[model samples]
Target: MSKLSIKPLADRVVVEPAAAEEKTAFGIIIPDTAKEKPQKGIIVAVGNGKKDEPLTVQVGDTVLYGKYSGTEIAIEGKDYLIMRESDIFAVL
Candidate 1:
């Protein structure tokens, strides 16, 4: 698959989550109904360093996002996310 190569501006980031069919710590196969939306994602694209504020992160950073963070986008057949920097809860 092709990857996107655009950087967002101040207070924005792009993210992709791990797949949903992943196994549990105890080797349990989580049913779809038993799974919650994953809040963990890796930053694929980052903003232009947040407009004069020192950039807290960069591309390839893993982050914890809000439950309802970001708008979804599909670029070149791959999925991505766009959201405010504030929407990111923490860097992991």
Candidate 2:
């Protein structure tokens, strides 16, 4: 992966979202209009925790989050999401 130029502040994290699924479990092709928003992503950047609390997730960690958790952004023509650490659920 290329180095990112953006940094998040205070407990916020920047994520690279997984691409939307293009096929169903049964091998059926899904149209773009029917593809659901991805709820999983990889942590690419992290912020220092507030004072005493340390961040549990780190760069390169794959995690799950709310379907609508973060704000979408484009960095160097690539898409990403920036959200608070709380929005992330579990590390996979």
- Candidates in order have lDDT scores of 0.71, 0.82
Clashing pairs in 2: none
Root-mean-square deviation of Cα positions for candidate 2 versus the true structure, in angstroms: 4.8
- Regions more than 4 Å wrong, model 1: 1-3, 21-38
lDDT of 2: 0.82
Name every residue pair that clashes in candidate 1: 11-85
**lDDT tens digits by residue: candidate 1, 1-92:** 22467768776878886455467433534344654543777788877755478568667887777667789998777778899887887776
lDDT of 2 at 88: 88
| lDDT tens digits by residue: candidate 2, 1-92 | 57688879989999998776665343434344654533777899999988888899999997878778989999988999999999987887
Worst 10 contiguous positions by lDDT, candidate 2:
23-32
